[model samples]
Target: MPEKFDIHQPDDRFFKSAMSDPEVVKAYLQHFYPKIAAIAYLSSLKLENSVSLRPSLKRFEADVIYRCRFQGEADGRFYFCLLFEHKSKPDKYVAVQVGLYIMELLSSMVKKQGRELEPVLPLIFYNGKEKWMPQTLSELFQEHPHFIALEPYIPNFRFLFQDATRLSPAALLELVGVLLLERTQPNFVLIEAR
Candidate 1:
């Protein structure tokens, strides 16, 4: 067996390259995206080319986007958008950022096919030293004395959050090994070759 490579810096390039691998992505989804996994099979995943919806936004430049079809659902497909944050501290506006990305993805999908927008699973892969605390969009909102009344009007969305810093060593090694292999040879086949 090949030795596992350690990902010292989990930057945008690192994530984009690592997550491009179907195996790595499959493992990631299996572990982090339970809701999607329950509905869709890993074999059904097909990677799509990522587009930059907002070129002017500097922070949105390095996000990775993937589109795939569900195993049983023949008529519909969904997108998976991953945003990597390598900063030591978490961004307070992560919710808003993810929301914008989701809207952009929906708009692109609608324009491409002239059909109803499909679902988008926005995910944040944080590898910072600190533990990620904010799990939902509502958590980022400012608390007010009468916030209950305004809650209904707020545009809210939840993202699957994964903190690599929290993963066990064995699990991390598996993920990293797949990532390194995939990065080295994108066309590297798995089960199909066997």
Candidate 2:
């Protein structure tokens, strides 16, 4: 028999734990995806209590969902979901998959039939070998003359995508620039690079 090395590393558990904290998530938004972060009042961010349709997601406890109102407007609420997917290569149907998750979340949120649904922004952090720039719903289809008719009703919304493969050393510096971690995690050695 060949020798096998077994090392227990904090995979999903660490991810779920770290992402559960609003501050950590806030720091991530503030640091990398500032434009999306600006859309919300980050102070009012609260985690929503919702179950997932997938068993894998349930076992991993990877659902990091936050609900908050717009920066200035308090009447309506917005949700931004953080999904951490580590794929070796970019999947073409990633947008469809993300869309399904967002739709599932939306379905779970609706209590009444006539009530309006709050906007939910799906944020994908793609850490993989190849670069991925997420496409909007409209972009997924062939943009021929015949396709022009369907464009208006395509329900276009872009995913807040971050491709880790394309990140430079500067981006790492950018990531840790605003993150001053108080919690000690073996996985994170956040050094504030000027």
Candidate 3:
């Protein structure tokens, strides 16, 4: 395994490389969250195989969003927003970052076509050093004055995290080992090998 504090910035080439190898992505996600592997596979919609990690923004930035079409049952095209944030310790700022990304995605879409569009799902794949549990209304209210209670409206399918920091050492090793294995590529290999 590589060093723990790998603050090295992965370039566009790296992104393109992984995008080319759908197996790498599937393995990475499976390692990140084995419990939700099935759901992740379903939601993947065979997207990595069809699309590239083409960033819309000129400036290289965090929360890079990628667009892809679903080649699965429905064949619906969707945008997968990938937010990369690395931290030495756990914090509550993840919500703010994800919130900003979601806002940016909708705002950009509306601005492009000059019209309102339906909500797009934002699946955040977190490779950070913390476990992200979305802040609740009560928790947020605690920080502010109690004069008016803020009823937070958190929508479903808004955000999801691939929590690496929270997983046990054994689990983490198992996941990484799975990801590193060349033969155990994507779903087919997973099904057959398992």
Candidate 4:
């Protein structure tokens, strides 16, 4: 008998393994993460050991973190957290989850080394069949008389989102090519030739 394959379940293992590879991660960021690529060099990105907020909390299961030095800036560092969503349905509270994870990362750094809060860029990669509509934390909130008045007091944060299902075939092919080249050649520079 042939083995059965499940499509609805989240493949956290496969996503984590691919994102953990230095070359694959670098290529991914260079091609998909424009804002981050603008501030940091791909060569400077170093994958950090995944940190757990608590033993009871398994939020870090589908997430990967990277530490990188800011280009042309002394004493500048950035934390990039990539959270993968592989389920068929999108979570309505994904922003809240990401915000909590970011706070946990900051808290961990402060407790361990007393370092100043570093800027963290939270990115979400969704490959589900459903289209992701929400873009910011504020979007998930219900509009009410009091809520409208207190909007300024609420903590607002936005995460970069990429839906693989929406990408064109040519663009997907380009990304694949880039990943292959990067994997084969460690020193491959992604910058276009002058």
* Candidate that scores best on TM-score: 4
Arrange candidates by lDDT, descending.
4, 1, 2, 3
What is the C-alpha lDDT profile of model 4 across 111-144, one tens digit per residue? 8764666777777767777887544666655465
Error of 4 at 23 (Å): 1.4
* TM-score of every prediction relative to native: 0.72, 0.68, 0.51, 0.77
Clashing pairs in 3: none
lDDT per residue (tens digit) for residues 73-102 in model 1: 566544333433333358778777777777
By TM-score, the candidates rank as 4, 1, 2, 3
Worst 10 residues of 4 by lDDT: 79-88
The regions of model 4 sitting more than 4 angstroms off are: 1-10, 55-62, 74-88, 178-181, 184-194
TM-score of candidate 1 against the unseen true structure: 0.72
Where is model 3 more than 4 Å wrong at Cα? 1-21, 30-60, 68-86, 114-138, 152-158, 182-194
Model 2: per-residue Cα lDDT over 83-169, one tens digit each? 443334577777776676677767666855654577777766666566667666778876666668878877666767766567788
Clashing pairs in 2: none
In candidate 3, where is summed lDDT lowest over 10 consecutive residues? Answer: 45-54
Question: Over the full model, what C-alpha lDDT does candidate 3 score relative to the true structure?
Answer: 0.45
Q: Relative to the unseen true structure, what is the C-alpha lDDT of residue 44 in candidate 2, on a scale of 0 to 100?
A: 79
Q: CA lDDT of each candidate?
A: 0.64, 0.63, 0.45, 0.67
